[model samples]
Target: MLLALDAMGGDRAPQEPCRGAVRACESLPDLEVALVGDGKRLEPLLAEVSSNVRSRLHVVHTEEYITMEDSPSVSMRRKRNSSLRLALDMVRGKEAAGCVSAGNTGAIVAGGVLVLGRIAGIDRPGLGVPILSLSRTSLLIDVGATVRCKPVNLVQFALMGSIYMRCLAGVPEPSVALLSNGEEDIKGDDVISEAREILKASSLNFVGYVEGKDVPVGKTDVVVCDGYTGNVLLKFGEGLGEGVFGLMKEEIRRSFLPKIGLAFMWPMLRQLHTRFDYEKQGGTPLLGVEGTVIKAHGRSKARAIDNALRVARQFVLQRGVETIREEVAKGGM
Candidate 1:
């Protein structure tokens, strides 16, 4: 299984991404990596790491690196061999099954749209983030891919996200829900209202409106929204988790008894942590596309990359994208 890793696109850049790729390679004996970046600088890091991952790592040179400060659309041209662009190229050329980028979201999305292209009849594509909660796992689309979308676009997003849950996540008949301000039919804006109406006519299992609170509650398997709202909701949930965990830590540190209790509950805490670990769920798969495009978080570490690579391998092996298109055509509703 061949996967391309963008080693110079995140805040941690070469070092972090390189280490993650090495970890992934070591973890998966059959995994082959085309690590894209400056080979000269990467060699030293490889020497420092103890693993024999160097044997499986294939270096793809990209002298120019994409920084978080660089404007994605224009900065892409500044370097003929930018890491993000090269990683996309590998996927486009079928040299690798997929490319994992933790760089500028704009560059990754733009490159995916321009280089990988969209699936037939898919007007726009959204980043589908799988949400794992206590009861179930669901998918939320347009986490940050498109800033805005129309009613038709929302309908398409719902269909694609639903199909993905069925094919990839194994939700036999995933329920589709429109992200709304309220459960009432007339509660949302015209765009969302119209999307709701259109989705009601869709062949998939349309389950009416889903509010923000229902998001992590797993009432629906697919939640569709414009990127503006989707991104805010996603970040909000993440922030809440962090805040609660911080408070819990502080409380535990306040007393020796609490510290002892925490130590005893360490296993449970670890299990709880894994429940929300994005790495365990893999990178957000870019749906409504011609091929698989897994976008790892910019701060992703070793385990995340390992899981992302596995996601790529799974998509190719199962022909996931093709099944999604077929399911959409059949209107899984």
Candidate 2:
């Protein structure tokens, strides 16, 4: 399968993304990547890769690119020839099976909606991140796609999230829950409350409200919330994980006895670290869009970019977009 990548989007653009394209093509022999960026910058990087892997890496040169600080509206209107725009264009034109970018989240969302359009019955496209919890991995939808959402939007997010977990994560019947302030049915704002009721009535395995703490403990297979809430929760969890690991490292350095203990427990510690590693998780899917769009972290490097490309490949292979369309149509949304 062929995938279009915005090589000039991330913080380590061109270099890391270029190397990542080569790595992806190396790992997935059948996969091909069209790196969209400046030919001059990317050519030198591509030249370093072995001929066998380099052959699978195609460069679609574009001098323009959307910056992290660029306004979504302005960028979409003005940067018509940008790497980000061209990458999405490739997906829209069916030149590529999917599009991957570590670019401006706002620009990706806006461009995705305008260029790819929304799937039928999907009011807004939600970004779904696969969060690893204590018991199992759960899908969090609307991590930063649509901040201000309506009741119908949250319900739609739940539907999309459930479909994602089922198709990609291999959950037969993913349990869904609303991320509310409390677990009580009466808790949450008007939007959450109304969405809860609608979800409960639907055919989905709606498990009612799940508090913020419940998310990390794997209370539900799919945690549904507005983009604002989901974004805050996701970032907080990232910071907390880093802080805890840092504390562990600091404590380990403070004592010789702990150092010896760490030697014995290094395997388990490494496993724990890998579980919370965002690099391994790669990117989150912008569900509800017409085509496959995976949003890698803006600060992504080679490893992260390679994994994100793998994710895009898996998403397309799993027929994620088509599954969501079928589910949404069945729900009569």
Q: Which candidate number has the best lDDT?
A: 2
Find the number of clashing residue pairs for candidate 2.
Answer: 0
Candidate 1 structure quality by residue, lDDT tens digits, 1-333: 888888886677788778778877777788888889998988887886555777788888768888888876777666558988888888889888888887887777777877888877788888888888767888888888888889988888888887788777788888889989999897999999998888888677999899988988888999999989988887777677678789989988786788988878989987776676543346877887776778777777766766777777787788877887777666554
Q: Candidate 2, residues 1-333: lDDT per residue as tens digits?
A: 999999998899989899888889988999999999999999998777898988889999989999989999689879999999999999999999999999998999999998999999989999988878678988888888888799999999998988888877889989999998998877899988999889988888999998888887888999998888887777787787789989999999887888999899999988877787743359888999999999998878888899999999998999988988887788732
Name the lDDT of candidate 1.
0.81
Q: Evaluate all candidate structures by whole-model CA lDDT and list the values in order.
A: 0.81, 0.89
TM-score of each: 0.94, 0.96
Which ranges of candidate 2 are over 4 A from the true structure? Answer: none
Q: Which stretches of candidate 1 lie over 4 Å from their true place?
A: 48-52, 279-281, 329-333
lDDT of 1 at 206: 90
